[model samples]
Structures are given as structure tokens and as C-alpha cells.
Target: MSVPPAPALPVVGDGLLDRLLPSVATSLGVAGLARPGDRVLEPARRAVVVLVDGLGAELLARRGGHAPYLRGLAAAPGSRSVACGFPSTTATSMATFGTGRLAGEHGLVGYEAYDPATGRAFNELSWEDGPAPRAWQPHPTVFEAASAAGVEAVRVGPGFFDGSGLTEAALRGGRFVAASSLAQRVDATLAALRTRPRALVYLYWGDLDKVGHVHGCGSWQWGEELEAVDAELRRLAASLPPDCALHVTADHGMVDVAMDRRLDVAHEPDLAAGVAEVSGEPRSVQLHCLPGAVDDVLAAWRGRLGEDAVVVTRDEAVSAGWFGPVEDRVRPRIGEVVATMTGELAVGDSRRHRPELLALVGLHGSVTLDEVAVPWLCAPARRA
Candidate 1:
């Protein structure tokens, strides 16, 4: 079977997080926030960036009827979709968002990456027993830069994230306000904004993404959850103080994989052969091949998976700009063989991942438009 050609690589400096956060920081007058001018957002005295997990631009356009508020925002002037970088998962995108850099510079390559220092698969999200967050990702976050510039930086999210390893790694600085519910988060963000004459507030909402993962992006549950998020966002936007601007975006979009399209490497001898470890999420898998087995592993996966996935060697991936100019130190963490799912197909290792993870209906990580493109919708605060 002939494998189809890979999609065009993400527009690194222009569309990805490398430009987004720096633009935000610059707009807020944060010192040491280095980057080119933003193509999406305008300057504001107060800005609130809301990262709604799993809210893909394509998904939103297709399901706009279910979210009137978001639909209006999408249709607003200057609203456009931006590409999240390769392996467009939360862990990778969050690091990209926080550090205002690509995976190569920030070193959070994937959801789960091979940590050469520990000889284990490091889970970027949980970070349990993994390397120290500061040491693992040393880049100063946009929040930290904003705080250093004397701009009040605030993060409003769930209580558990107040001091999580992921937070420490990506969003270390700032006043962390624990808000368990959407209403609480909105309230906390508003209060934080009021605390300072100029502020940069980061708000996170994960329920829609959770629902999409469990029930599939096509399910009514996903639609219902999106509706709830839309309603809450409507309230939040309406309540923002004058001179505050609200910017909405996401880590990545999701695709619902049919059971027939799901490939279990554990069952496929060719795919499992010479693979020392399987990391990354379902849509994009990182295969750590054994010594002298790189060619064999590559051939096995390409021959077996064919057009259902794009199989590329690490060098090819780097050449293709997947991780965007990988650093020398970060190069080792990438898999020797990387496989990115295409269309509706997903590859997973049931033996390595949790049953719940493998069972997720909606998944994202690949470079497909449905997974990589997210909206950059902005609504400036209305004066009373």
C-alpha cells in the first residue's frame, strides 16, 4: 500500500505558541518577553487568556450551532485559527504556551517522552517521580516574565493545580487562585484582575475536553459540555471589567476514532518488534527502538500501518520541523521512530497505557488540521 504524503508542517514562528504568548506578554508590556509582534491579539491594559481544553477550530466551526456565544466570537473581526505545533497534545502545547517557545527550546516534547536521564518514559502531565520541573523545563514562563515586569500575573484554575509539577514547570510564577468550579474560576479571575490596575490572568477550563475524551467529540455529551462552557464564557466575558480583553484558545482539537480504526501495537508483531518502549498519546506514538533496530522498526511500522499513519524517522521528523529546531539536549528525548495517525486512525499500545486511556473515544496529538488548528478569538471588554 502506498502511504499518502504528510500534511504541511505547522507554521512555527507565525501560528504556533512561540508567537502567541510573547505577543500577549508584549501587549501587557511584560519585560524580557521576547518575540515578534502578534498577528492575533491587540494590546490591552488587562488581558485574560482562557485556554479551553480540546476546543479545536474545526470542531467549533462544525459544531457552532451548539455554542452561540463562541460562534459569535468566531465570526468576530480578527478571529482566526492558529496552528498548535506537532503532537498537539496538552502537555506539549502547555509547555509551548507557557514558555512561548517550541518543544526544542522548552524540552517538553510530548505527552510522555523518553527521559534519557532516568531511562524511563517521563509523563509530562503527572510528573510523578520524574525529573525536577525547574530542571526539566528551565525557560521562564510568560507569567513569570509578566510578574518580573511588575505586571500582576494571575492563574485561576482547580485547587489541585496550585502546586502541581506541571504548573511548576510551565507556569511557576504568578498568584495562583484555586477555583474548583467554572463560576469560582471566573470570580477568582475577576477578583485578581481587580487587585491590580494592570493584570494578566490565565484561566483554564477542562470539562469540555474531559467529556470529549470519554464520550467522543461527536457525542451529545460533548455537545452538552461545550454548551455549558459557552454559557459560562458568555457570563465571564460579560462580567469583565472595562479595559480588560478576553482571549480564548485551546491546547488542541480532538478526533473521534472508530473501533475499527484503532490499532493495537501489542497485537501487531511488526509494530511491536524491536520497540523497547511506547510513549506519547494514541494519535501520535513515539517508539523507542532497540540498538541497531531503527531501520527494522521503521520498516515494520510503515509496512503494517501504511497510509493509516505517517511513519517517519527522528531525523526526518526533525527535518520536517515537527518539533521546530530541536535543541541538542532535547533531541535524545524524542523517539527514534515517530508515527502520527492520519484520518480517523489511531495507534496505541494497550500493554503500556491505562485501559481508560486506550478507551478514550476522542483523541488528539497528530498533525491533522482537526487536531492542530485552534481558534484565537478575542473580545475586548465593554465599558459600562
Candidate 2:
């Protein structure tokens, strides 16, 4: 009898966003970094990583027809689907991607992570009223590492990101080149590559994720955005130098949750009872409990959410490899009781969350396959 294939590596460590950049740095001959996924990339003098926010592997598979260029790259050799890990939101995933370290080590564990030092939750994406960004996440980014090793590192994204606290914390190494539109960003990327023989460039796009949050991931608008991205990337691919390689990836995937299936904690006394705070996103609800209230809060959330969510104690979640070796410093940021929503169900708080945010068509930040599975697609540039 033929032997079954060996079980895949756990999504927490090996096949993850934390390793993608290290692999890229490795392929570019950057020294002093261990390359866990060395073979995930091919050796190249120049590399361009295009991070399409909210582009999940499963979503791309289901909507392949709308993104032919990206779909073809996914089908190419060396292309595979990798996990974005637990709490698969942009802030967490970007910390993982930029630092080549897991959320536990990076300490930006959630979109709105609780800072034990300040005794308050802050929006990691916005970095408003948060702890000093450098003090929060002190890891040297892969960009910084690569630059130190003599590779030119550049980041091409929105102008507002140019010296933002989030940039200072996680992505501080690279020179920032702001481009407002996709076309401008693409042009900027091509120009940046031409300036140096060995360079690591990053291009960020968010319109797809914006469309998904407002119009739903499966909506025609999202499909059209995908098509537009595919067309733009196709144009980019044709202009790439032969010595370069292009890697396309994402922060997380999304799933649409109907308003009827959502629970508003402010509207439900039982759900909000003993929770000191609610910090995480709708799909992944983190409930910080009052002193001596862990068990009660866990039980209450469990009984209330039922099969709609998998409720767990903070200790239980860490043991389950959810955050991938969380450090002691990062422990309190996680809640006493955490709930990962199941199916299309979600829990939001009308009191804590804005009405517009609660009305978002698509939601993420959970361990579902749709939320964690991101594409690891790569292709070489055209011949000169």
C-alpha cells in the first residue's frame, strides 16, 4: 500500500508570514539571519514584495477568474499557500511580516492590543495613544537586516505612512517613497529597482481590503478590484528586470458576517457581564476579566456564544500554539477569556466599536482557514 503524505508543518511557525521576509532576505544574500524557508524563494539580486492586504489564498482560489495574473502565479511552481497565524488581522500579520518574528515576540498581538504598561488597549494600526512604538516592538525588521547587509531597502506605500508610529516600530529601516495610487506605486517600485543592482522593495495596496470591508469579499466590487489589481500587476510583471523576482502575498483573508448573526455585547447583558474590557476584532473577541473572574467570564462567554465560538482561557490559547510561543511580556495583552468565532458568526460591542465598524460587510481576526491561509506566490522578472 502507498504511504500517506506526512502531516504538514503546523501553521504557527514554518509556513507563516514571520518566515516569508527572512526567506526573501536569505535569497538576496543578506547575512546574519537564519533562513527557515530558504527554499521558499529563489536567489536573486533584486526582489519586490507586493503585499495585497486581505488577500487570502482560499479567497483567491474561489475568485480566481477575476484575478487571472495572480491566479496563474499561484499555480506556478514554488507557489504555495501559507498561514498568517492566529488573529489574522493587518496589524498582527504586518508585524509578523515586517519583523520576521511571530506576534508573541513582536508584541503587537491584536489590531487593538491591550498594553499592560498603560492599562489600556490601543489601535496598533493607527498607533494612537499607544506606547512608544519602538518600545512596543523592538525586533529588527528584515528590511533593516537586509539593508545592513548591503542591500538597498525601499518601501513604497501611502504618504501618511511615512513616519507613522507603526512605521517607526515595525518597518523603520527602509526609505519610504509615497505613492497615492496603484499606478503611481507601481511606477515608483519600477523606478526604485532601477536605482540599485541589489535592492529589496515593498509595495502595499489596500483598496481590495477596503472594498471587502464595505462591499463584502464576495461582492462584485471586490471582484472588480481583484481584476484591477491583476491587470496592474500584469503590467508590472512585463517591466521587471531579469535579475529580479516578484513575490505577492497578503496580511489576512476575510469572511462576511451578516448583521443577524452578530452579537452586540452592549445589547446583551450576559455576554458583557464580568468582562473588564473587549479589545480584539469582531471575529476574535478578547475579554479581559475582573480580578478573580477568569473562570466566571470564560464560562459566561462559553455558555452564551455556545457553538458560535470556541471559548478558551488565556492559558489554554497559549498552550494551543495560537500565538506561537508568547513571551511573558505579551501574556497580559491577551484576554482572560478569548473567543474565536465559528462559521459566519461574530461578536461586536456597540459601546466599544463604532457603528460604521460594526456595519462592515467583511470581518477577520480569527483562526479560520479563510482568515489564516495566505498566498506565497512568486515569479521571476522578464528577460532584458
Candidate 3:
């Protein structure tokens, strides 16, 4: 596919994280603080990127001791945090990381969106059973680019994701290695790294995120999971062959919305008046208002949501760089107004759908520092 030039949008205050440049620059041989090229730019070598599903920078900062390996990475000189794009949700942020494009361009939009074409909420993550991957998101991932460039790329995750819709749309390029256990995943990642001199191995761990969503980020189980994952990374780092590098990052962070703050649109008539549809997560509510009701929607949302959220029109969000450079194709996916939850939850009729969402102990999809910021950790490759 021909790479189209990104639009000429002003690259400022887009709320899109600038911290990702270092990683992209490092991977592609551009100069940056954590430039992998400095050490592993050799034509034949290995590079490992471990993506911990729900680990955020703020979470790391508060509970550094919980994960010693990751803590050391964050505290290391030159380590920093990057902002996840608007809504700060996992699917959207991961697509951005994989394709190196904004949500507007990739068109993943949110975790669940009312697919205009389908007239129902399309869940991108589970689309393997929901829709064809290419039909949902047609863009080529950066993994494919690396593979075609002869840089061997491998994706190591759980068995369930081997052929899932999320994998195809955002992570289609690499060879898939499904491992159900952390030990298995770590082993698979190390094995893939040893196969080629120049390799990109992407590893994913989702248990922490799962625990957080179930028990909230404050649970001891979630902290223990972080420690366990960190221990696995440390083991992998120690076993790296000579002349390699390992980098650690995440899709986004988590925020635990209070139960008292939960507002059901079904029961709240004022909040439902102008809203044509409510998609995205409760924290990041995408309000598709009735025709000519954009202003009324904004006002109602602001008046109702109050200081608990950052309410902005879709145009304002695009102008503010919320989605990076908005592409012509991605514009329609955004609603006339979006309310990013700040201090509470704006849940739908949880009785009808999203029991898990209502039960989630930890939440995300907001601009709060906890949800948007992620860490960048780099270490010299381990040599055998």
C-alpha cells in the first residue's frame, strides 16, 4: 500500500504524546535519548519490546517497589513518560503504537463503537468473532513494514489472541507465537529473538490489566501481578544473547472510577436528551448528538458532568491534537462532542450490556495523568 502523506495539521497541543518519538526514532535509527541504534543498529542482532498491558507511568511511580525491574527502568536516567492519545483507551492507543498513526487515521475509534455500517457496537478487540479484521481496519501495521524490510518481526502473546481481530488489524505483520503462561511467553520471546540477527520481537502481558479491571488498580493482586511480570522481564533480559537491546513500554494506564460516581444514561433523562448514541467507555463517552444538537449536547454534558470531566466538541478535540493529525477517513468516527471522564463514570445501561464494565475495579479512557501517561524503559542488550 502506498503511504499517504500525513495531513498538514499543526503538530502542537494535540494532547497526543510526544514521548513516543524516542522509541520510533530508536527503532528506525533516528537519534534520540533511548536510541537503540546506538547499540543494536547492527544489520543482524535482536531487539525486544515488552508491552505490559495496563501498567502506567503514574502507577509505576506510586508502586515502584512492587516491580523492581520496571522501577529501575523508570528511575534510570533519560527514562520518561509519554501521553496516550485521547480517550486513553487500550485498543485505540495500541493501534496508534502499532501503526504509528492517530486514531483518526486508523479508524479504530474506541473499544466499542456503533459501527455505522453495522448499526451495532463493534468491539475491535473481539472482532475475530465479530467482523473481518481487514473490513474493520484496513491500514497496514508497522510490523508488516518491518517484516517486508527483512527485519524479522515476531508477536508473542496468549493463545486466545493468535487469530483474534485485534491482532489482524493492529498487529498483523509479525509471526504469532501463542503462549498461555508467562514462562511460556518469555521463553517464546527469547526463542524468536535468537532466530534472526535483525529481529523485532513484541511481547504482551495482559493479566495485570485484567486484575486491575476486575479488582481495581488498588488491589494487592494487581500489584503482585506487576511484580511477577517484572520478574519475568528481568529473567529474559538476563538471558539475552550478546549484542542486543530490550525496551519496555505500555498501551495505556488505568483509573478506578468510584461506584458512587457512576451515572446510568438510561436512568438519567437530562444526560440522555440530546445524545443520539453513547459509545466508547463510560469514562470516555462519545456523544453522537441529534442533528443541530451539537451545542445543546455540549452544554448538557458540561452542565451535568461538571468539574468531573473535560467536555469538548469533536472539532475542538481535533484542533487540540487529541487524535494527532486527524485524517479525512477518521473524522466521521468521532462524534460532534466527546466527554472524557475525569472524576467519575458515565456508564450506559449496564443492566443490558457491559456487566464487566460495571464490575471493573479499575477503569481508564480519560485524560487524567494516571490513564494517559506510560513509561519508556531501555537497557543494553544482554550478550551470551
Candidate 4:
């Protein structure tokens, strides 16, 4: 089957993250949240959100044979077969996922964005040496909202993320349970549900994303991982409380760029001219131009990269609704000039990024359908 045609998605409206949490909030009759599309998620006593990182809808559709349970969900009318908006990356998507708001509102702009306050580039995912989590992302997450409403919220993931900057910034609140394996995580999810009659449970799985990064998403390794994910989720669904609904989703999709398609600025003088720093995705580069050189830097990058990428100023991108209503504070975190790759091209910065990062087979963080489309599948309580 041909991949589904995915036009540019406006996060404010056509995003799964837009209403996911708010819908859950409404299901529990939690007020204060603007509950747009609350009907998407059926009213249930409990809800379990299983976030499979890098599990794009397009990829799943293409390789549906490997995921019988997911394929069935994709074919279901209620399932959002595709999900995502601009700058499709983990950290940015997770911000929207947790807060049920736009990237501009959440302020986790990109994979790596320039911080005007520090005059440095920081990774939004790892959040090492980055801004204070609470101060940086002031928005109250859905977990916090659920907690405030007296709903028991549980987030299950690895041990390292218990107090990580990203977790605190985007997914704070609730009891964080650490489980190393898939079975352990599933057990923890069930345990958390038992603790409360009405609860919001979140499960984060990074194995597929890691496998996709190391091996291309189209590889057999990725297919194997998908099969494993499908089985575990199926098991989890079977084991879910009869009153609880299970929702399966992801942060973003993956696209495998050829080694020859990744262009390093260090190798091209013209591409690096007038540039102060480089951040963002390899496919979508955020160029922080030197003072009084925004035009020149944009021109140089546009000229050098040619048709492989669409280069634009940050102001233009914001105006075009790329970041979805940029706030005064987040305006500077975006690059002076942003270059989002058109196809399988990536702008790599060898000087700033480690060599290991450049060697990744699968890369995302662009608006392309392959990179932007994620799946939001629901296993409703009635079905259980």
C-alpha cells in the first residue's frame, strides 16, 4: 500500500496532542481545561496512554503485517491513523503531548534550540545544563492537572528519567515508577491502576526509537522491535481494567537519510558563512546567524543548499505558523534562520555535534509525512 498523503498539520487544530490530555481530563470530568474534542476519547473511569517513541503511522501502515493489533486499530474509524505537527521530534512532541498545547506555548521549540539567555545551544531531550525545568516550561502538564483534580496519575519509565530535566519540565507530577523491561513496565501500569479506581497512567517506551536511530526504521531490526511492541501492548490491553481505556501513540516518525545526503557545514565554507551557531535537527537546522547577518546567512544557506532544503528566517517561520504562535520568550530560542530539509537531506554540524550523532541511520525532525505521521490507536473499555 502507498503511504498516506499527509499535508502540513497545524498543531492548534489537526494535532493528536492537541486534545489527547484534555480529552482525558474531560472524561474524568476535570474542569479548567479547555476540552476541545473531548468526545474523541470515550468517557471512562481510567485511561492508560502508551507512548511508543518513533512509532509513526506511516511506518506502521507500510509495515502493518508486523503489527496485527496496531493494524486493526489503524483501520478502525475512531483511530487517528496519523498524528503530529511542525518540527516532528521527540522533545517538542512530548511537550505538546504532556501539556496538550503548542510547541510555542510549551517553549520546547526543537530537538536542539539556541538559548538566548545562555547564548548557547541546548538539547531539549537530554536537558543537561539547560534551563531550570520549572522556570523554562511554566505550563502545568496534564499529569499535574490530573493530580490537581485529585485524580491519581502514574508515569512509568526508566530509572534515569525519574528526575530528569525533560521529565520535570514536560511530564512532571504523579508517582513516577521505574521499570527496566517491558514486562516490568506493564506490571507497574497495572499496579498503578489498582491503587486508584480512577487514574491516568502513562507508559513511555524508547526501545523502538533507539533501534530506529541505530538501524534504519525500514530495517528488519525495526520490524522485529515493532513486533515486540505490538505483542507487549496486546498483553497490556488484555490485562487492563475493564473500565480503563488504552491509547497507543508516539512522539514522531523516522526517515532514513543516506550517508551521502547529510551535508556538514565544516565541509562547505559558503554554507557556514555569517553563521554564529547551528542547532535543531539534521533534517531541520536552526542557524543562529551573527548580528546584522541574518539576511546574508539565509541567502548563503538557501543558495548553497538549493532545492534540497527550504531556508527561511525565524520571523517568517513564526509568521507562517511553523512553531504555532511564538511567544516573546520563545522567539529567540528559534534560530535567526531555519532550514528544513525537503526530502532525505540533512544539514549536519560536525563541529558542534558528536561524530556518533552524525552516523545515525534514521533521522527525523522535519514536516515530511514519513517523519511527521504518528499513530493514536485506542483500545476502548467496551472492547476490553
lDDT order of candidates, best first?
2, 1, 4, 3
Residue-by-residue lDDT tens digits, candidate 2, 1-384: 122222222463237877888888888999767654345456799999999999999899999999999999998987888889778899999889999888878888888899877777888889989888888888899999988999999999999998888888888896999999999999999999999999999999999999999999999999999999999998888888999999999999999998899989998898888887888889998888888877778777777888777888877787777887898888999987778886789888898788899999999998888888899888965445
Give the per-residue lDDT digits (tens) of candidate 3, residues 1-384: 122222222222112432352354345443323422322332225678788888988898888888888888777664667677765787887787777667877778888765665545666677733556667678777677677767778999988887778887777886899998888999998899779877878888888899999988888988889889989998988888776777787888898777787888888888788777777877787877888888877787788888887778888778776777777766777877788876756565553356766777688887777888887777755445
Itemize residue pairs with steric clashes in candidate 3.
14-321, 44-197, 45-197, 216-361, 216-362, 241-383, 242-383, 242-384, 244-381
Q: Model 1's lDDT to the true fold?
A: 0.85
Residue 53 in model 4: lDDT? 95
Over the full model, what C-alpha lDDT does candidate 4 score relative to the true structure?
0.84
List candidate 3 stretches off by more than 4 Å: 1-44, 128-131, 382-384
- Each candidate structure's TM-score, on Cα atoms with residue i matched to residue i, is 0.95, 0.95, 0.88, 0.95
Name the best candidate (by lDDT): 2
Model 3 CA lDDT for position 135? 71
179 Cα displacement, candidate 1 (Å): 0.8
**Global lDDT of model 3:** 0.73
Model 1 residue pairs with clashes: none
RMSD of 1: 2.3
Better of 1 and 4 by lDDT: 1
lDDT of 1 by residue, 335-371 (tens): 9888998867888888878899888899999988889
Error of 2 at 84 (Å): 0.5
Where does candidate 4 stray beyond 4 Å?
1-14, 36-39
- Lowest summed-lDDT stretch of 10 residues in model 4? 1-10
